[model samples]
Target: MLSVDNLVASYNAGPVLQGVSLSVQAGEVVALLGRNGVGKSTLLRTLVGLVPSWNGSIRIDGTPLAPIATHDIARMGMALVPQGRGIIGKLSVADNLRAAMRAAGSRPALSIDQAIAPFPALREKLPAMAGTLSGGQQQQLAIARAMVGRPKVLLLDEPSEGVQPNIVQQIGQLVRKLADESGLAILIVEQNLELALATANRCIVMAKGRIVHSGPPDEFRNEAVLRRHLAL
Candidate 1:
């Protein structure tokens, strides 16, 4: 339900994203894969209006998104779980989630209990300070905060980064469940090729800030494609 066309973005005269184009259909999980500095995160940021699009069009369910404020894009049903798990360190877990819901302009369909059900460990840490949680717990909290918005399209940037193996699996399962059960379109920028292939039906590979390959996840599983575009 999201489409980006011929997107070009740069920072301080150096191009970061060059004419990147891609789309995500409702209920589909599209994995964005690239080596370091390929602009996968830049594309995600540009899509959500965090970065200005120098040249391109972004449409969400037919609504055009300009180079406007991030909140404005979020209000239109897109929520981003940024790479760093951008949570307020001092805020209670509950408040952090509530803030995300307010930012999305709606109360969450899933209650804190229900939302944390997917990550049972988070349920017990409701009153804890976000900064005090483990990295995995913090990542789960970040996803939980995004879920509190009940978004149509969830943009996740490197959810598994720095997370332990078990928690990464948990996050993967939750991501797949969100797409399958809730019909939430997911565009994930991930460095972990195996995790992306396991969770996503489709994969888009970027090289030097442009899309080089887009196809079924299985198709991208080839050794040659991995070595050429993704393996670092």
Candidate 2:
């Protein structure tokens, strides 16, 4: 499980995340929805230590996390699939996955085959350069790499971005399967409404760096409610 309490973060002289708070339980998928610049992505980055937290606490399974390095955070069972996929284009797909496992440092981990099982399309591309793959393939590779570490919490930023519709559905199915089978707690920042609804059990809406609404997916599906907070 992951708990973030009154998290405050800033960029330069301006604050980006103002007292944001949320939590995700094991075997649950939570979608974070909002318009652009609402600090959805910043909250993810802050939880993973990419952005410094100015105040409050982030705890993984009740352990404070702000004191550790990002790599250590990954080793402590947190994995992030960043907004852009963030794959190493020049490296072979196998190497990219290997890097994450290496950073995870011998925790009970998933084999390459197990990691790639959800993405059978990526199984054959293991020896190929990651940059040469299509956008969907690259995103699959990114998710696979994150899973190889056998993380307890998965932070996914815009998993649907730049992905084809079919591939987005594939990702959604894989995410739901992971939550159910792997007990992976997922916090996904997504703009695509349908993808969010399909992938997450619950939805949290944010505005101006603060969470404004939290409920089941059906409440989020109501057009008027969604439009009020997300302006979608």
Q: List lDDT for all candidates, in order.
A: 0.86, 0.90
Extract clashing residue pairs from model 1: none
Q: lDDT tens string, model 2, 38-137? A: 8988898888888999898999999999878888888889999999999999999988888778656568677888888888888889999999999999
Which number leads on lDDT?
Answer: 2
lDDT of 1 by residue, 1-232 (tens): 9888888987657879899889999889999988888898888888888778789888889888876688878877898999888988899998787777665565445567766778788887889989999999999999988887678899999999999998898889889999999899999988777789999989988999899988898887688877877774
Task: Predict model 2's lDDT versus the native.
Answer: 0.90
* Candidate 2 backbone collisions, by pair: none
lDDT (Cα) of model 1 = 0.86
Task: Kindly give the number of clashing pairs for every candidate.
Answer: 0, 0
